[model samples]
Target: MHDWLDEEDDALITTALELMEEQRKEQNKTAARGQRAPGAGGPQYSG
Candidate 1:
């Protein structure tokens, strides 16, 4: 766990996580609009 993070560090980490979540949501929206995802695997693995 990140229990050792102080208040400032916690705030920074939370902000970074929120930004990442926003980016993920935006990417999902783009994919829903027919754009390929960042790492578009052509097909499922059969292994």
Candidate 2:
């Protein structure tokens, strides 16, 4: 039972990491383009 739970947790963590990396790449692209217009809110991110 515990082993199954561990495997599940690992899978979830791996998925999350992949998603975060993709997000970082996207953010970099947007940043290279330039900042958003005033009052036009964009994605809020954290490291």
Candidate 3:
């Protein structure tokens, strides 16, 4: 029914938001350390 669909949608939205928040936190940590995140490519040091 409609209620079940709404619940599924809400769960999907919540999961998406949580993933975004986690990614943001990881990016912040990477920035603070001046290192590239995994799968971001490139080297962390010049020599």
lDDT of 1 by residue, 1-47 (tens): 65756877989999999999998777556565543453463333222
State the weakest 10-residue window (summed lDDT) of model 1: 38-47
The deviation in Å at residue 23 for candidate 1 is: 0.4
Candidate 2 backbone overlaps, count: 0
Q: What Cα-based lDDT does every candidate model obtain?
A: 0.65, 0.72, 0.71
User: Which model scores highest in lDDT?
Assistant: 2
Pick the winner on lDDT between candidates 1 and 2. Answer: 2
What's the ranking of the predictions by lDDT, best on top?
2, 3, 1
Per-candidate total of colliding backbone pairs: 0, 0, 0
Give the total clashing residue pairs for model 3. 0
Query: Which residue pairs does candidate 3 place in steric collision?
Result: none
Better of 1 and 3 by lDDT: 3
TM-score of 1: 0.59
Error of 1 at 13 (Å): 0.3
Per-residue lDDT of 6-41 in model 2, one digit per residue for the tens? 999999999999999998888776665544553233
TM-score for all predictions?
0.59, 0.70, 0.67
